[model samples]
Target: MSWTKVVAITGCDSGLGWAIAARAAREGLVTIAGMYNGSDTEAARALKNLCAHPYKLDVTDSKSVTEFQNYVKNVLQENPKYKLYAVVNNAGVMTVGNYEWQTPQMIENMINVNLLGAMRVVSSFLPELRKNGAINDFKPRIINVASHCGLQALPCFGPYSASKAGLLAWTRALHLEHFRDGLSVISFIPGGFIGSSNLTMNQVENGNKMLSHLTEEQKSIYEKRIRTLNKYLGQASNNTRYDSLSNEVIIETFVKALIDNKPKQVYKVEPWRYKFYYNLLKMPFPDIMYYWIIKKFLAFPDSE
Candidate 1:
């Protein structure tokens, strides 16, 4: 704790990112918070007074990510003991609807933010990890903020789940690929939280905008279901941050993923009932059959 350790965390505008950045700063680590918005946002204001230094970073942009890498390098050069200890890829986006109902633009937007965005950040900051491993034989880490949906049947949250699944796979690959380099990569699969989660009216508003993209025929077929799904997801996403109270306790799994010397490849913290489903996904049942059964029973009938 006495040594200089820098932790860069993306998506600090809200939800898990803000909580983690705030918590890291409290723990005395140099926390760099990556935010997509300009300095006027509440996240910028709240994190400004703490250990977190909000940096403008659009993980999807090469120029932005390059700038972030330069920033980390400059920070490390200020002191020989300073190391870029970790980069928490926490920025993500979610769209709610049937997969077939999603427009090409919607699909691209989701992936660009959720999957490629994480990839861009990791690729950009990897060089700074070099100095970290040389210090006290310590390994720099990459903690990817994934979801339990990557582990099971997340239903209407398909696109978002797909992105997380890729993240899970990518994390595992990095863990293996960089083992000899003393770089630790892990995935944190969150179940739910005790405060207001990320999904909210903002996505509902975005979903409404996408509705305009549908053809008249398509709208007649999928409009009702899409609206219903978005409303349900808005409630579900916000509720995931907390079971009853609004607090930063939900960021514990993230902290564990970062500080543990030998972190689990996938650190999970969810509800009691998720265990059964988690096991269910791993059973010998064929994926096709399992999905079919899930759609037939667990999901409501699609609108004609």
Candidate 2:
């Protein structure tokens, strides 16, 4: 009996995750989509229409992940030819603010969903993925959807950057640890698709919550800047032109990463401008110069 390949993806409610699942299904792979909003959502319905399996999954909750794992196991049992091939950790959330403005819960939530959440899903399915790879004579891959923020920290993205950086580090470690077992792990950086994704959907509300927790002195110091930042985020999140191009490039990169015979350790999809910025950051530049360039590029408000 010939085996069919299967790929399980998290955060398929919208954006990159949904796009990847749709593409995988179109490519004749059995796609399992883990949607945080449950299987009753419009996104889930759309995925089902595309012939992908959509399940309610909350990566931050171990119980939810376990249930998802069980569901996948049942899928394999029901379809003997279906072999789990890849796990894509694409579910993430982002909130923008100064480090001082981020509450403990905000920081925790970012790390939980962006960093630890991936770990939970991988841990639950890794043994099976390894077994399938060993028996099937193929390499099982873990594609972690990281961000360029992990490579370079930008103002107002402290917690988000930290979480992504941790994820990158973990991906490297896992890859090295499991190399002999024929497991492949890589990071995929889908740069700056704010408009196409729900990542920044709560920017305004989160800004308000951040302000509510600030002391009078803190508010006086940060209120104007926070409002400016929020406005900037709102505008950036509505720039459909750039978002459309970014989505296309990112989806293309994902397709390559999924099917390439010898996949790269990191696949980054970004505009030439961001590529230039990353190159400049790599040069031996002074801290002041880096800060100045980033401030100008990001339009951060000057310190009072």
Candidate 3:
């Protein structure tokens, strides 16, 4: 078992995944970029141009996970020197809506992709990691690209929040459960991103479709809040120019997660307000104070 530094990053076809892979490649770590959309995206083309190896991976499918694992294993065997240094579970789907209005499929898809899909990939690649891999590199890491929704739930983003909350717990458990095995699971909490960059449009479209099934009476009860939430989402989607957002912050965070001697248990890419909210939520305050302020700005009204 030889030790070589290599990192596997999933969801590399777009968003921060692509950026992370590109950064990893530039930093001289043998990078494996995983993409679900085979040969069809502009992001795919960009990823292929980097110092990385692109592979087809569908984390939602066990067969696809196994095949990707086998392929990587073969490549490592052929080299006889390189080993997987880190596994990053970055592929996730989001669904935002009133909890009651969310269809079963919507709820299931969110949980399955964001939670179980990552579990499949991590479990599938464990043996390779254990075989003189990142443990030898001195900092073995299993990272989950979680979200702020996990820590702080908004009103209408129930499904997405639920999924991420589960991921947060899952990461915490893995961090403790696999420590003796020399595995460190880091939870990355990215702020709400909406636009051509991340996955907001798909989530919005699917949420609307699912809500269409609601009866007129059911819709009436939540329609005002739904529209308000949509308005809020539109505003958020337009705020891509957030002061704190940058290639450097995201890429560096990724590098630290994979290569830093001591990585933070929770790497949050949010501004000071989020930190404030997190702290505020822990306080035993009345509804007229911090909680009320949050609902006014961060959340849409929800029907009881």
lDDT of 2: 0.86
Which of 1 and 2 is ahead in TM-score?
Answer: 2
lDDT ranking of the models = 2, 1, 3
Better candidate number, 2 or 3, judged by lDDT? 2
Q: Which stretches of candidate 3 lie over 4 Å from their true place?
A: 133-137, 231-245, 287-291, 299-304
Among the numbered candidates, top lDDT falls to 2
Q: Enumerate residue pairs that collide in model 3.
A: none
**Residue by residue across 1-304, what tens digits does model 1's lDDT show?**
3468889888777777777888889888898888888446777877888846788888888899888878777877887777789999988877666676776877787788888999999888876675466666566888898887676646667888888888888889988988677788888877654135564436677678668877899888878877776666566556343112234445676777878877778888766566655666677899796776556534444543
Off by over 4 Å in 2: 238-246, 300-304
lDDT of 3 by residue, 1-304 (tens): 4466788888776677777788888888888888888634666666667757888888889998888888778878888677777889988777667678878888888888889999999898876665543345466788899988888787667888888899999889988877667777899876644553556646556557655878899877876666666655655555342122345766676677777777778887777777777778778888678657677557454544
Query: What's model 1's TM-score?
Result: 0.85
State every prediction's TM-score relative to the real structure. 0.85, 0.94, 0.87
Residue 213 displacement (Å), model 1: 2.6
Lowest lDDT block of 10, candidate 1: 239-248
